[model samples]
Target: MATVEVDQDLCVGDQICASMEPEIYEMRDDGLAYVVDGMEEIDDDDLIAAAKDAADACPVDAIIVEE
Candidate 1:
């Protein structure tokens, strides 16, 4: 499984990660991007790739993906 995280402290509410990977990242009511619950461990390769892409697209580099 792949491990994913979003550091809210560094998040700028860009929503890039959410737009890029809705299944892995979401824009919370607080305006910061967050890793979807139960998504800390992703088993699908497509989802993992999406998570990595989202991490790369984050303007503030708030998303983290470790596979």
Candidate 2:
């Protein structure tokens, strides 16, 4: 399992994370990306892959994954 973390300070509200991994990452009212439960339910490999991909693609490099 992977825990997703987003750095609000660096996030640019790009929505890339939400597009890449809807189940794992979401856009809050603040217009920033935040993980769902930090995406604790994302145990499937595909979902994890998408989440990781989103993290890697974040322009601000604000996502952090912990296994």
Candidate 3:
């Protein structure tokens, strides 16, 4: 399984990650970041790809995945 995480300190409030992985990424009201995937863990390769694309698209480079 793969896991996605965001470093709020580095998030910069960008929504690119959200756009890239709407199933997993969202922005906080305070302009930080959060995982809204509605789950506590990642389960497969497709989820990992979506998370990776979101990470790659984030200008601030805040998203990360553990596989």
**Regions of candidate 2 where Cα sits further than 4 Å from its true position:** none
Clash pairs, candidate 2, are 36-39
- Candidate 1 stretches with Cα past 4 Å from truth are none
lDDT of each: 0.87, 0.83, 0.78
Give the Å shift of residue 61 in candidate 1: 1.3
Model 2, 1-23: lDDT tens per residue? 77778899999998988987788
Q: What is candidate 3's lDDT per residue for 10-50, written digit by digit as tens?
A: 88886787777778888779987788855337887787788
TM-score per model over all chains: 0.92, 0.83, 0.85
How would the candidate models be sorted by lDDT, starting from the highest? 1, 2, 3
RMSD of each: 0.8, 1.7, 1.5
Considering only N, C-alpha and C atoms within 3 Å, which residue pairs clash in candidate 3?
none
